[model samples]
Each structure stands twice: as C-alpha cells, then as structure tokens.
Target chain A: MSRTEAHPEPPALAPGEVRTRWIVSTPPILFLSLFFLAPFLIVLLASFQYPGEFGGLAPLLAQGDSPDHGLTWENYQFFFSDTLFAEIFLKSFLVAALSTLLCLVMAYPVAWLIARSPKGRRDLLVLLVILPFASNFLIRVYAWMIILGPQQALAQGVNWVLSALGQEPVNLLFSPFAVLVGMVYVHLPFMILPLATNLEKHDPLWLDAARDLGATSWQRFWRVTWPLSLPGVFAGSALVFIPVLGMFAIPDILGGTRDMLIGNLIKDQFLGVRDWPFGATLSILLTLAVLGLAGLATWAGKPRRGHD
Target chain B: MTRPSPWLLLAAGLVYAFLYLPLAIVVAYSFNDSRLNAEWVGFTLDWYRTLFNDGEMLLAARNSLLIAFTASLSATVLGTLAGMAMHRYRFRFLPFLVITPVAMPEILLGVSLLVFFLQALHLTLGMVSVILAHITFSIGFVAIVVRVRLHGLDEKIFEAARDLGATPWQTFRWVTFPLILPAMAAGMLMAFALSLDDFVITFFTAGVGVSTLPLQIYSMIKIAVTPEVNAVSTLLMLLTLVLVIAASRLDKTFMKGAA
Candidate 1:
C-alpha cells in the first residue's frame, strides 16, 4: 500500500534508464519553463518598467543608459499611494468570502444527502451535481442574466412585492445580487463534491452510539457531525474562495457599473487604460495575495488534516 | 444509511432546481418563435437557421475546432511523458511545472501569457498564440488523468516485461502503452473540451480580428439579447456534454481529475 513498495525504485541504476529518464522529462520541463514560468518572471520584470508610448511595456533597453529607459518603482508606489486599489482588493476578498459562505450553505445539505444515500446511488447523485457545471461557463452566467432580466417573472414578482411594500422597483440584472448569484451558482458543485467525499467517510456507528446514549437529533448533529466536517468545509472554501477572487466575467456580465473587482481593474489596465506596468504590478500583487492566502489555509488546516 | 429527512429532501430538491431551471429555460427559449427570452412564445427553428447562415459565427467555430485539435494533440503527447516521469522518477521540479497551471487562478495564466506573447516574444496574437496558450494549461489536466491511470495499474506487469528481456522502450511499447491508451484518450478528450470551452484565457490571447466560439458568443451577448445566442449556447452545451460524458465513460477517473 505504501508508495515506495507499490512502485519501488531500482537498487541499482541502469544506463538506459538514466537516458530514458532525461529524455522523458526534458520536453515538459522545457515547455513549461519557456511558456509558463518564463512569462510570470517577465511579468515581474515588466512591473518595474514603464508603459510604452503606444501601449504595452516600454523597451527595457532604449537608446542610452538614461534613467527613463523603462525602469522605475512607480507602479508599486502608485498601488500603495492610492487607497482605492487596496479598497478594491478588500472588496474582492469580501465578495469571494461571501460567495464561499453561500456555496457552503447551499452545498452542505446536498452533499449530506449524497453521503447518506444508498451506496449504489452516490455516483449518480454526485454526477447530478456536476452535470450543470459541465456546460460552458458563459452559458451558465447568461442563463442567470435571462432569469434576472427586468421582464422576467422573478424580477416582475419581486417588483410587485416592492410596490406593495411602498418601495421602488429595482433592476436585478446589473447588480451585486446578480453577481453573487452567478458566482454561487457557478461554484456550488465544487463545494459539494469535496464535502460529499469527506462526509461519505464518516462511520455510521458514531452517530448510532450517540443516539443510543439518548442524545437528541440536534445534539447529535451539533456535537458530532458538524464538528467532524470542518476539514471538508475548509477544503471546499479554499476551492471556491480562490477562484472567486480572480473572476471577471460574472461581474462584467451581471454587475452594475460600480461593481468592478481586482480582476476588472487588472483587465482594464492592459486592455482599456493601456498601462502595462501598472497591470503587471496588480497581477504580481494578486499572485502574492493568492499565495499568502493559500499558505494561510494550509497552515490553519494543517492540524485538522494531520499532515502537510 | 439513514433515509434523508423531509426537510433535507426539500432543500436538496431546491438546489437541484436552482441548477437546472436556467439551462432548461435557455433551451426552451432557444426554440421560441419570438426574439425575447423573457417569455416563452410559439416554437420555431428560425434561430438555428440563423446560426447556420451566419458566416462570421461559422468562421469562429472553425477556428475553435482547429485550435482545440492542435492543442489537445500536442498536450496529450507532452502530458503523457510528464505523467510517466512523475510516476517513475523522483524529480522535484517537474511536478511544480506540470501542476501549477492547473492550480493557479486562470486569469493569472491568461494575463501572464498575454504579456509573454506580446512583450517578450513580440509575436502577433492570432490562432497560433491561442493554441500555444491552450496547450500550456491543458497539459496539466492530461497529466493528472494519465497519472491517475498509472496509479491504478499494477507495477508488476512492467517488471515482468523487463525480466523477460524487454527493454524500457519495448516495455513501454508492449506493456505501458496499451494499458494507458484509454486514459490517454480520456485526457485528449478532456483537453479538447477545455480548449473548446475556454473563454477567459482565449479572451486575452485572441487579439484583434481573431475569434473563437466563446469569444464570438461573448461579443454577441454583450451587444444584444437575441434567441440566436441562446440557440448557439444550447448547441455548445450539447457538444460539451457529449465530450465530457464520453470522456467519463472512457475513464471513471476523468470525473475526479476534471473536478
């Protein structure tokens, strides 16, 4: 069952095996280094440089050794000097956290149901959760736009209730509520799958023991099941929270004019404002933020999962 | 297992409805006689007819197919190598290179590649750039699928092949290759599907005048709310559904890797 035993390393190395290892490993290592690793490094380098006269990054080595030859700390300083950028970062975290919370709330019951289902039906139930997600991402968001459009039944019903309550009618399509709904809808299955996998591993005998001791149903859940499921919750939250931070399409399609997140800001820099250095700066910051959060999640969940 | 309580059943049913109602409405409204998606009108095939006749849309479809084909083909070969290397060797850096793309925020990949292509390589953004970008992210998925397949295989078979005087290449050709063929097929299909359905990455890399199906759909939806968009979406959904289901059938582990 151990990894080494299952695929044992040879005690002695063969000449052909060494050659084969180098040959097999070289292509992907080279390809990823060039296309994947090199690009991020370039982004970091570009962050220190100036924006080109036309658009993209200014040439790193222009004319002479002049100070204006496309290098400065202006991008990072700009990000720090303005509180607006920090506020947007905070807003993105807030949105991502809220979406993760909503996904957990919606997914828990479904996951629990699947976990407690007959063994033969678990795969079918899990597949049912994943089926909607298999459709194109844009199509999922577009579906919500239709449902939340002004003339749609849901919007009309909400407006009628608002009128009866002496409040103004609200447009549902281009709003924060629409963005959150789209996010939760898109990410709910991620929460469900991990949670179901975890919950399915629980021993029914634990619950039976608690029940035999005259424990109430509520006590059994609160004192036993809920506490046992925290690891799954953390795993699912990380899955939902990280992606929601970088999402732009949902906000672009479903949000109001004022609903821009870090993603839209980074996007606008390159595509709209034509500031490559600033965009690269924001991207590097986001990467750092993601890595920090991922590290924190690992540190926090380390004891619960009992290993690295 | 205990039966689900009635409240649990109701909550789960609502979630299921939340998932499916939007897609059902889209398909139904695609067939509506009217242009508006707000209400269901009479049935008609006008939208499908319109989609077929739209020359620009057809061009985008062609581009998407071409990109998916080329990207998935190359990714499958590279990914199989990466997977085998990870399984058979103890390289520290290879796992990082192979897995980071699959794990990182996709927009980061998209923007970084945009910078790399435009600023470093100074290559004009076009079909070739888009295909390269697709291959970059897709190698990870295919690697994961191949790795999972290899894990389920018995190591004894390869040892037996080697003991019988088969060389490493011969062992791979006669033993490992046949065993992992289904997983490779599943990986390739998954890659093809990912490439075809990609939007955020393609959005940054496609540049001006180059369009894929998702890019084309995005522009159309932004400009208008027509049944034509819904028709195309339903068709795209059906196509992806078939591809994913087929991949799952070829390898059950595809479900795990994909999720």
Candidate 2:
C-alpha cells in the first residue's frame, strides 16, 4: 500500500487549522474587498446620491446646489417616469429570454451528440465548439456582417435560389432575428459545456432501467434524463441568460443602433450623455435583477440532502 | 448505450457548420486580394503582410498581450488564494460573495466600474483601469476552477505534512500547490483568454487613448471591415487555439492523476 493509504485519518479540528484557513482566505478576501466589493459599494452609494443640475453627484450629507446633495430617488424617478427605460428593460429581458431559449434548443442536440460520440472523436468535436470563442468576440460578430450582408455569399446564394423559385430576396440582417442568431451563436458553448458536464455524469443504466420497466424512449428521456439534467439546464440557462441581458455589442452590431437594449442605454448614459449618477442607478438596478434571478435558480437547483 | 442515430449526426454536423462557416468565410476572405470585404478576387498573403506592417494594429496587439498577461496572472494568484480559502475553510457568506461576480451581468459591472472610475475616483481610462476591471471578472473564474480542483483533493496529505512539522506555508507549497497546479494553469489560461477577448467591460472602462485588439477591432468594424482585421483575428484565433490545447492537455493530465 502507498504511504498515503497506510496513514490513519486525521481529526477534523487539527492544530493550526484556524490559522491555515485564515491564511488561505486572507489574500483573496483582501483583493476582492478592495477591488470588487469596494468599487461596487462606491457605485451603490453613487446610485443613491442625488444628481446635480449639471448631471454630477452632489454631497450626500451637505445640502448644496450640486446634484449629488443628500439622498433622493430623482434618478430612479426619472427612470420610472420615462417610457424609454421601461421599454428598453422589457426589450432587454425579451432578448435575453429568446436568446436563452435558442441556445437551449441549439446546444442540447450538439451536447448530446458530443457526449455520445466515440471517445476518439469527442475531444475534437468539443475543441471545435470551443475554438470560435478564442477569436475576438467583436470580430466574430463582425463575421456575421459578411454572412448576412446583401452581397454576402450565403445571402447571394439564397437570393439566387429564391429567384429561381420565383420568390423575392429577403433582408434578414440588422433585425431582432439577427441579434438572436448572434447571441445564440456566441453563447451556445456556454450552454453546451455545463449541459455536457451534467449529462456526462448520467449513467446509461438509468435509461436501461426505464426501458426494462416498459417505458418508451421519449418517456425514459422525459422522466430520467431530463430530471437528471435540470441542474445543468438551469446553470447553462442562467449562464447564457445573464450575459445576454448585459449584451451591448451583439445587438449594437447585429441588430443595429435602432434596436437599443438596456445595456446600450446604460452605455449612452455614461459615455453619450455623461450622466454618471443615472448610469450608476441603472447599473445597480440591473445588478439587483440579476442577483434575484440567480437566487431563484439556486433555490430551485439546491439538492435535498436526504433525497439524493 | 443506444446505437448512433444518423439524423442526430446530421443535425450536429449542420450546427457545427453554422457555427464555423462565418468564421471560415472571414479567414478565406483574409487571403483574398480583393479590396472589398465581399467578392473575393483571388488568394494572396497581402492582407497578412498589411496587418503586420500596420503600426496601429501591431500596437493594439501588443497592448492586448500586455493587458491579458498582466490581468490574467494577477487574477490567477488572487483566485488561487480565494479557491484555497473556500475549499479549506467554512465561512458564512463565502459562497454568496464568491458567486456574485458570476451572477452579475458583465454590462452592469462594466458600466458601474466606468461610472466609479470617471466620477468618484477621477481615474483616467487607461491600461491600469482595464487591468483592474479584467482582474475583477477573471478572478472569479479562476477561483471557481481552483475550487473544483481543491474539492477533489485528499485532506490527509496536508495533515500529514503539518504533522511532520512543516509550516502552513510549507505544507501548501510542498503538498497542496503541486496537486492544484494544473487547475491554476487552466485558470490562468482561461483568465488570459477572457481578458484578451473582453470587449464590453473593456469598452466602457478603457477611456481615451488605450486600445486593445478587441477594442481596435470594434472601432475598425464601426467604420468598416478590412481583410487586415480578419488576418489579425485569424492570428488571434490560432494563438487562442494553442493556449486552449495546452491548458486542456494539462487538465487531462491532472484528471488522469486524480483518477
């Protein structure tokens, strides 16, 4: 037997355990507290601050002519009163939901195939799925510009085929459809990876058991495979959905400037209009929404200790 | 296992094609001698030559490498520490705090940072801001990877080392570090790739005068598409391919060792 196997088990409360744990955690805790937590706190505080007349933050405690004087809901009030903010928020959610749905549809089949493929070929297929992500994201989205453009080879070929069939050429680019395509294309791998990981854990015996119990293939899948894979499905969906909500470049590039999402609005607030406080408020709200969704997913996915 | 279905294979093949065809077209057009992004005339290496010769593209590439290297390295270090903490210790709010970045949208993070930097901090948009922002997101990924690795580890080894009079730091360096090195490497590589590919966050935080390859590509696309950009992209893709292969190989080796 190896030395490791020969050794007796150690007690849980070993000496130096507390110190070691503290040492292990301190660096990351320090880094995150300073960089991630602090900056976010700053933004959260900025969000609550009132906006100056010139669109800057006034001092919170001091009453002044500046916009950032004590606590006020003026920025959020502005967001609520404006129809554009609501429209943009709803549109962003729709885009994210549709994108997540599309990714689920697209990724499931690909992941299933990958999981079932011969071991020799599986790695290569997985590699292909991951390869596109390595390229510049904006450039890959730009590639669609060529594919979906009027003179794009695919479009031209389609146009030719349509003319032969007595149909008119279609303008498919620069639409919500195009944005959905881009989002799915970009995020499919995120969906696939988590799904594949979960699916790979599933034993074939479960299916065999179902079959032996006189279940049809569809029934076996719906009862066994689907339930088993819910964790991954939720995870992958959240992964794709959350990012799609914040997506700016995909819609901006593919759907064009006309289809502005909330991300674009936030960007416009900061850079275009130079409204930092309002932008901060939008960001905080969006962050809260994401946190809420994530919390829901976790609650749903949490395993019952005794049941499993 | 069931027999392989032909329909399933065909569907997978079509999806792969859909995913790759646009990219393949860009690569093919990079070699075309045509001035227009569309309508390939013939194959030529001129675009690559132009890409290499263009000072702005080269500078952008250099900046991208610099930012990715620095940000990813820092994220790896911090993430490893965080992962070790989560794995070794049970703390209240640990999971919640660790998962916050994962759940938060990149856009909100980006804009928030942009707002903080511009308004509150009064920091200029430059390499420092970009690196800080990249590290913020990349560290979470690295921590997750390392956390997985740590979960699979045997605790007895560390206990034995400590019993043998090794200090906590020594126990980690001699016992824990080597075991988790593969995950560290994977996390670092992922961090680098993410930093290199980051557009949205970088776009917001990267104030005036600082440009990485993705930022450069974004600006260039806003104006027009060029074969030179495609060539640069092809090169970036190849580089990413190499790094991913290396990281995956390391990961497989580590998995094998663990198994």
Candidate 3:
C-alpha cells in the first residue's frame, strides 16, 4: 500500500486524546531521535573533521593557532584523489551486481516452483527458504569456511580434478570464488521471497490463454511470465544488492589478500587504522550511493509499473 | 491446478540442497572426532564439552543472553508504542525513523553508532553500548510485527470498550493489551533472536573486552579452527531454530516480518 493511502485522513483530536496520543508516541520518537537520527548527523559531521593526532577525530572547533585542527573536506578529497578507493568502490559494485544476478538465476526456478505448487504448501515452502537465513549470519559464512577449507572434501575433490587436468591445485577458501559463494548463499532468500510473492499473484489464465493459442512453453515464459516478474526481480535485487554492497563480514571472513571491498576499506579505517574521518566519509558516500541507486531504480521501474 | 514440471522440481530441489548442504555439513562435523573440520574421524561429545568449559565462550554467551533480554524487552515496549502511534496517527518522521533502520544496510547503522558512541556520547563501547545499538535496530522489527497485528484488528472493539465506562487507560490495559499480546510476544522473540544473532552492529559498538556470541564466533572462525567452533555454531543454530518455531507459533506472519 502507498504510505499516504495507509494513513487516510487524520482526525481532530480531543484534549485528553491529544495527551494520550503524545504519551503513546513520544517515547519512541525521543529514543530514535536520540540514538538513530542523532548518530547519523554525528557521522556526517565526523566525516568533515580532521583526524586527531592520536586517533578518532580532532576537535570540532578550532584551537587558538591551528585552523587545520578543525573541519576540512580532506576526507572526501582523499577518496576522489585516490584511484585505489575508486577501484574498491567499483569492485564492490561489481560484486554486488554479480551476487544479485546469481541470486536471481538461482532463485527464479525455486520461486516459480513454489508459486506453482499446491496452495496448501506455499507457506511451508517459504518457510523452508527462510529457515537457513534465520540462523546466525556468521555461522552461515563459517559454514562455507568449512566447506571450502583447503583440506575439506569439496576443495580436495576440485584439486584432484585440476591435477588430473594438468593444472596446479587451487585454493578454494580465501578467494573471490569463496566470497561470491558466501554472498549468494546468505542473500538467496531475499531474492526468492519477493519473487515468490510476486509470482504467486500471477493469473494462471493468462498463461493458459497463451498455451491455447499454440504458444510454446518457452515463448509463454519468455513473453508473459518473465515480463510480469520484473517488478519482483527489482524488489529482490534492491534487497540483495544494497546490503551486499556494504557487506564487510563476508569478504573479511571469506576473501583473500587481494579481495578487499568498500566495506572492508571503511572497516579498516575505523577498527583497523583508527581513522574516523575517512571511515565516516566512506560511510556517507556509501549511504549516498545506496540512496542514488534506489532513486534510480524507482524512476526506472515507474514506466514499467505504469505499463502494467 | 497442474503439477510443476519435473525439471522445475529438480532445479528447485538442487537449490534447496545448495541451501542446506553447508549447514548440514557443519552440524554433521560438530560431532566428528577430528580437530579439523576436514573429515569425520569418529563420534565424540568432546567439542561440546570443550565449548561448555571455555570461560570466554561461556562469558560471551552470558553477555549475549543478557543483552538480548534487556534489549528486546525495552525494544518491545518502545516498539509497541511506536506501532500504536503509527497506526493511530499519521506522521512524517515516525514511520521513517522506525523503518529506515530496518531498511538501511546494517553496516551503516553499525558504523554510525560506533561514531556516535565514541565521539558524540563519549561512551565506552561495551555491553551498554551494544545493548543500545541492538535496541535501536530491533525496535523497527518489533514495530513492524506489532503494526501488522494492529492492521488486521477491528477498531470497533476498542470503540466499544470506550462506549462502555472504560477509560482510555482501562481500555488499553484491558482491551488493547490482551488483543495484541500475541504480536507483542512474537515481536519480543523476533527482537531477542535479532539481538542474539547480531554481529555487524555489535562488532562496531562492542568496543574492546565486551564480547557477544557473534564476536566470539567471529574471532574463533578467523583465528582458530576447531570442532569447538562447529559445536557452538550448531548450538546457536539450534537455539535459533527453537526461537523461530516459538515465534512462528505466536504469530505465523513473524516469518514474513523476519524476512
């Protein structure tokens, strides 16, 4: 439902009702303003301030002699000045795109099957999709560590195949391959659930009508089902894509020396190198990137949605 | 309705297999006698025994439980209020504030909270900070669940309570509270699970010396490889499984809220 539609019209409040409404709403408003909204503003401010001599940020206000002790656009400048940072941003975008695509491909068949299944079993199927996701996120990543460990069966089997093919044995863990696997494994449900929800709403009569017109199954799917499912694909992609873009843990745990992404770079700034300004700058840019892409997606989807 | 194609069934089956195989391996290997997660040597309870005895792991678990309990309890109360507020009155910022945290990439929340605690609040990164971060994120989830519950309900019942001699507080305490109890329960469980499983935000906000199960698990996964990690993972999965089942029983749509 549209948010405006959800709200309807606000009624005039009685005096006591006004107080009751305030009482009901104030606690959360105050709490979120203090913690949620304030922190974001703080991070925005932190991004401009200079790094302290020791660690964290320098003073917000200028000291007696040193204007350099206060704010500067140095953090943002450093981001734009360095090709390394740009490359990491590009790499993260590529990883997010690839993960979304992979999730889409893997999720489509499962979503289609679930939608076409007996109505009695759809909830159970959805639950099955969500079951793995409900487990700890780190545990899910660690599962891959076990699976792709050098001495594990999957790796050993692959290396054996490589050796027989006259190639050197390849390490599976601590590789881009491992990171992609982790990303897809963790995010697949995000794609599946939305896709299934959309697919479940499709009118079977449309497909049947096409079939009766002597359309091939491939034609029916390509022309009808695929076109109708794009909205679902877009929703699922946004859910998978945004988080994957900022994901540090998957890459941190699964990637090798060469496979650093934006999340890792930002994390390194704060936890690793103790540079708060740079970290805050990266975070702000990432937030901007997410918002920009989301705005673009909504704009792109508008015409298609209007067509439907 | 016609049946799904055998080919489609096979494809979906493979996807399901892909999803479960890794987790199944972890569970299977937790009991393996080998020190490494490589191959099965023999069955032993030694890893679980090791997990029980490890002081750090035990403390982390205790901290996690405490944080989850405190955070979820507070979140449920605040979230119920937020939900009711949103349902009753139209607001520009309330829904935005509540929902954005749920929608935003979690790392952003973690990083911002880290910045806030260190710089703005001048607070130490420890259990209190971690709990606050947990509550901040979890409130949105609890609110969503409670809102969904409120949406299905008929307003006439509350109106009827007011038609009688019931005051606003009496109506809320006697009528509204009982009606939304299941949702409140479901929301609390959802929050508990979220706070317990949280890693990214807790990692940023937990500072030094305050370890949750996830932080402990992350270090163990990164620095050391032992069947003990597997044991802990298995137990965590089991705990989540129970919570999910309990939450779903309380409210079936909790699964949807969770997703």
Candidate 4:
C-alpha cells in the first residue's frame, strides 16, 4: 500500500564513514572563487581607490595624502551628490516594480486558466507560454523595434486607425511606456511558469471543500487558494523583478537616449566615463540591494508547512 | 472545475498574438525582396541567399556556434560537479556561492569581467575571454537545473551501488549521472542558447577584431536594419525553437521516469 514497498532496500554508509567529497567539488569551488568571487573582491577593493583626473585609477597611495594605501570615498560622494544617480536608481526600481506588478496581474489569470484547463489542452497551452522564451532574447527585443518604429506596419496601422477616428497618431515607441511594454513582454513567462507549476500541484479538493461549506467564491480564493499560492507568487515576482531591475538592453533599445536605468549608469561609468571604480561601486551596491530585497521577499513569503 | 471562460480565452489569444506577431512579421519580412524592413516589396528568397553569401555573417555564425558549444560543454561539467557537491555535502556557504551569479545582472558580470581582464589580468579580450564569461553565468543555470533534478533522486540507489563494491566514481557514473542526465542536457541546451544570444557580455569581452552573430547584428542594427538581418533572425529563432522542443521532450521523459 505504501510507496516505499514498491522499491527494494539499499544499504547505508557505515558509522563514522567519511568520503573524499571535497576532491570532486574543489575544482568548481576554486574556479568560481578565482574568477567570480575574486573579481568582485577586486572590484570592492577598487571602489575605495581614487579616480584620477583622466578618470583612471588615481595614485592616492603614492600621494601619501591618506592613511595606509590608496583610499577615498570621493567616487561615492560624487555619485551621491549627483541627483541623477538617485533618479536613475529610483527609476530602475519603479520600472522593475511596475513590470513585476504587470506580470503578476496578467500572468496569474493565464496561469490559473492553464492550471484549471483540461488535460488535452494543458500541454498545448504550456508550450505556447514557453515557446517565446526559447527564441534569442536580443532578436526578440529587436523585433519590438520593428514593431514599434514610426514606419512599422503595426504603428502605422494604429496611426491610420487613430486618424480615421479624428485623433492624433500615438507615439508609443522611445518612451518609458515602450520600455515597460518590452520589459513585461520579455519577463511575463518567468512570472507565469512558477505560478502555473505551483498551482498545478495544488489540490482542488480544498477549494471544493470551502465552497461546500457555504463559502463565497472570493472567500474560497482568499481562504484556500491565495494562501497556498503565495510561494509561487513570491517566486514569480523574484524571477521577474530581479532581471527587470538589472535590464539594460530593453531600455537601451526601446527608450533610446531619453531614458536611463541603474544598468545604463553602471555601463556608462565603465565604458563612456572610464570610471571603473565608480562603476564597480554602483554594481556592488545594486547587487547588495537586490540580495536584500530577495531575502525580504523569501522571508515574507515563507510557507507555514505545519499550520495547515 | 469551471467551464472555459470566453473572456479568459480571449485574453490568452490576445497575449499570444502580441507575443508572436512581431516575430511573425520578422519572418515574413525576411522573404521580402526589399532591403528595408519597412515595406514588404515582394516575396523572394533573396535575403536568405544574401545571408548565406555574406562572408562576415557566416564567420560570425561560426564564431557564435564555437563559443556556445565550448562554453556550454564546460559549464555542464563544472555545473554538474558543483550541483552534486551542494546536494550531497554540508559545506558552509555552498548555497550562497552557487546562486550569487544568478542575482548579479549580465551587464554587471560583463563589465566586471571586462575590467578584470583589462586591468587586473592584463589579458586582451578574445574568444577565450568570451568563453570564460559565458561559463561564469551559464554555470549557475546548469547548477540550478541539475540540483533540482538531484533533489528528486533517491539516495538509496547510490548507497546500493556503494554497498555492492562500487567505487564512488563508479556509483556516480552509473547511478547519479544517468538519473540527472535529462536535466543536465536541458541545462546545457539552455546555456548554449543563452551564450549564442548573449550580446552584452560578448560585446564587452570580444576583442576588437572578433565578431559573434549577436555582435554583428547589434552593430548592423546600429547602422541600419536590413532584411538579411531578418533572415538571420528567422534562422536563429527556428534553431532555438528546435532546441526548446527537444529540451521539453527530455523534461517530459524525466518527469515520466520520476513518476
């Protein structure tokens, strides 16, 4: 009757047994440490170094103006003083949050429908949802350029329709709205997949039970479905929000020179301004902020395993 | 369960149309005889011929393939090892370290790698640098997938193998590897697609002369949007579609196995 009865027993490790697990793991650990970890440490170190007049690493240590070696908060000071940094950071958060909210609003209904669909149509629906993600991201984003361009068929068509309606042509491209559209389009699947998976795993008996107990539809959703699906919502939001926050390509390609996000600022510091220290500082701060937000989300969405 | 809602169906259809319409237009325009992306002059295979005949595009395609193949292979191996270690061991900081790359944005990773190469390492950007950067991000993805598959694996199989006089390596090769192979394959394919499509990291890490497909497309789009680019995009999209279908098939098979 039990699932365990279907399989044969297997032996356990002897008492006090210790295997050489580190040998298999050390290579990857060392690789990540040297390449991934060390680079970030170097960036962190460089953040303290002064920026030269030519926007290179300054010889703060050589000047002997500061204690120990080259060190200065001038780059951070500059970034703080420049209101543009705060504006860009705030804009980045706003875009990511709005995109996340949009994805949740749109994806939940779709995911719920897919989860409740008949067996025959479920696979087809799932495939439809996932197929777009398989395509090259850059190509897909660029496809938006063709769709949103002034001379684009869709744009022109919309313009003609507006003209027929005695209204002005809509300018949807190269604006914050365009950026949001692209971001949500690109990230919608990330929100849907986790939500659908979790919803599919959820039992309908609980909802039926609630309905049978004289609960309204809203009460059933609030009492049974919503609490159970919180984990999925948390996961989907994190998946969508984090990448949207760090998105550089969507805003760059769609918003053009008019818009700037934290990603663009970081990129500009490194390439255009050649201020590696400042860029590294910005990147580290952004990474920490993301990590903090993710932690907060997970804590807030923690499932009460034993309560139910 | 409730019957199908017409409103829900309508919303789903509209969303699908919105998602696929742009891609459909690109594919349709690829066959247009016009050089510009705006007007579809007439249907012809001229753009595809142009895509094939262009030496630079061909070279870029080859480079993209080379980079994706090499990076995905190395990432799969390294990621499998890392995933297994995390699943089986109690090493402190293992979880944090493995998922760090996922949190960091690709642009930052690309820029940091560029800085590290130019400033600290004194290495010029080239194929090797691109591959290194690709591996850096791809490893996290592969690790996550493999770890998920490993989580569903029964520990008893490995214990049985070990008890039957099999070495650790043998146990892993015969039992663990086979069990997680589907996830590993899916991960590798996804990594390949990601590496091939990568623009930002490759853009930064590629040396002055080297050009990948995405890099070529980026530069070309900057100057002008051409039908040949559309042709190339169509091909890339088809290729990715095939890979995704294959991955999903493998996913189904793995799920069946688990069931």
Better of 1 and 2 by lDDT: 1
How many Å off is the CA of A15 in candidate 3? 1.7
TM-scores of all candidate predictions against the true structure:
0.97, 0.91, 0.97, 0.90
Q: Which of the two, 1 or 3, has more lDDT?
A: 3
Model 3 RMSD in angstroms = 1.7
For candidate 3 chain B, which ten residues in a row score worst on lDDT?
Answer: B250-259
lDDT of residue B257 for candidate 1: 78
* Model 3 pairs whose backbones collide: none
- Candidate 1 lDDT, tens digit per residue, A1-308? 13535777678768888999898999998999999999999999989998887888777787556445667999999999999999999999999999999999999999999999986788889888888898889999999999999999899999999999999999999999999999999999989998888789888888899999999999988888877877788778888998899999999999998899999999999899989899999999999988888877776654354321
Instruction: Determine which window of 10 residues in candidate 2 chain B has minimal summed lDDT.
Output: B250-259
DockQ of each: 0.73, 0.54, 0.73, 0.48
Please say which candidate is ahead in DockQ: 1 or 4. Answer: 1
Enumerate residue pairs that collide in model 1.
none
Q: Candidate 2: misplaced stretches above 4 Å?
A: A1-20, A53-55, A61-68, A118-120, A157-170, A212-214, A302-308, B253-259
What lDDT does candidate 3 reach at residue A183?
99
**Given the true complex, what DockQ would model 1 score?**
0.73
**1 against 2, candidate with superior DockQ:** 1
Q: Choose 3 or 4, whichever is better by lDDT.
A: 3
Worst 10 residues of 1 chain A by lDDT: A299-308
Judge the docking of candidate 4 as incorrect, acceptable, medium or high: acceptable
The global Cα lDDT (0 to 1) of model 2 is 0.80
Interface RMSD (Å), every candidate: 1.6, 4.5, 1.6, 4.3
- Tens digits of per-residue lDDT, candidate 4, A112-147, equal 888998887887887788788777777788888877
C-alpha lDDT (0 to 100) for residue B259 of candidate 4: 14
